[model samples]
Target: MCKGLATLPATCLKSAKDIKHKISFLLQKPEPQAADQKQMKEKTAAAAAAAAKRVPTAAEVEKWKESFSHVMNSETGRTVFTSFLKSEFSEENIDFWLACEDYKKSTTSKLTTRAKQIYQQYVEADSPNEVNLDAATREETRQNVENACPSCFNEAQKMIYILMEKDSYRRFLNSKLIQDLSQTHSDTAQMKKKKNNCDCTENRQALAGGA
Candidate 1:
């Protein structure tokens, strides 16, 4: 509903669009629509593990909150954050930033192909996932891409990273997904601690009887 946002200088409209996407993503059924309870549980667990990695430890999840770079550094953090960004339909920034990171590490042979794809997807004005960039920056990227090099998208990527660090990254830290993950890990830790205490109590009882 961020209407009339088809052109530049629509910062407010862009923010509205982001807000709309976040709301849409959050408004989901409490359970899978077509599945029975068992199926729902199985599917939910599998999907969560796939999207967020194997039940991220509380320590690991907390580490992500230390910085945007910290979140980007961990595989679990990246996977969860990317999924969140995609749900919000505002993934172009991180996606583009990641594409640039990959492009830089590409073998010489893959450089041109990766560069072309990155430009077509994120640099072109009408690209399916066009990132918000200014006229001067976009034009500069255009020239660099024509030549096809690893550094071609360096400037554009930096801008997108800043955009995300300022906007999306902040929202991500406060999102429900992160909250749920933190709670899940905390619960798991408590359950484990109780089990350990129970075992210790039984061991002490047995040792006292033996003595």
Candidate 2:
């Protein structure tokens, strides 16, 4: 029989029970098959990661130099540009612009909801993700929020666009992402040159054997 806790503060008994519960929980390990499945998942993920590391080709990287519009147009370019902007803590500009682009497609009935969301998210002074706009532009956007239409965010969007095109776009061209792409281009060119030389040597050896 368990001893009665004569109300002498059964704290020690409670502590002993808590320790027993923790030990039981710790001993309840995952089954062997569960462990094997987790290991399999990790290995599959590593394989996929290896496959996804392919470097962009020189032509693809060069297209970004054509214009700021080109970088925004290419999915890969946008990803790289976004990464650079994130590093600089200025990703909100592109984010707001993209949001406006998507917002433009909202149906007439959905315009008000989408407009208010965009305004609150990226236009208001106290918004969690507010974009940089002049006080006039911010006030103008706030006033425009009531009658929401497809073009509600037009002025604000244009400002952010120009901000990125003029400011961040130039910086991106000189950023480490661009520098890394340039290095990859050079490396690819060198590899092609070496391969061409090897092919020429093989052709010369074949001709000599024929003679």
Candidate 3:
């Protein structure tokens, strides 16, 4: 009998017994195999991580090494460049460029409407997506919107391109994100060279053995 059992009601004694049983169950040690499984999992994870680190993806190698024009021409480059712009809080720059590109491609009937939309959204002072243009460029764009030609935004677009090329372009090249990509490309090239050399040597060895 427990020392406090005499003072407790029947219901209370039953509750105390349940609590003690639960405590004992909770205190029981886990199985040895469980620990071994956990260790094995950790080691496997480490090995997989090492393997992944040793191999760089082909897309990473290509995207990082591409020329600016090549990057702008493809959807992948646009996405990557847009992400870089967003990080710098200058996504409007790309938006303006894309808008200009679309504007230039529009049919004559649609050119006026697209040009106005581009100017109002990206050229006017204090507009939500305004590009960082000088006063002369902004004034010229404002004046051009009234006439709204296909080439109306040309000068402004050129300025924004120069801005991105001089500023964002350099930062992107120097960024750690791009640097890592460049490194991955270099590593991938080295790996391919080594693999080709190994294949050649193996072929030579087989030929000599056959002879």
Q: Which of the predicted structures, 1 or 3, would earn the higher lDDT when compared with the native?
A: 1
lDDT of 1 at 169: 89
Q: How many clashes in candidate 3?
A: 0
- Tens-place lDDT digits, model 2, residues 57-119: 568778888799888876556656766786687877876887787778767887887788778
The C-alpha lDDT values of all candidates are 0.69, 0.68, 0.62
RMSD of each: 15.8, 22.2, 24.3
* By TM-score: ranked, best first: 2, 1, 3
In angstroms, give how far residue 101 of model 3 lies from its true place.
1.2
Candidate 3 clashes between residue pairs 3 or more apart in a chain or in different chains? none
Please write out the lDDT profile of model 3 over residues 76-158, one tens digit for every residue: 45555555676677877876787687677678887676676677678888876778899998998888888878889899999
Q: In candidate 1, which residue pairs clash? A: none
TM-score attained by model 1 = 0.69
Listed in order, each prediction's TM-score against the native is: 0.69, 0.72, 0.60
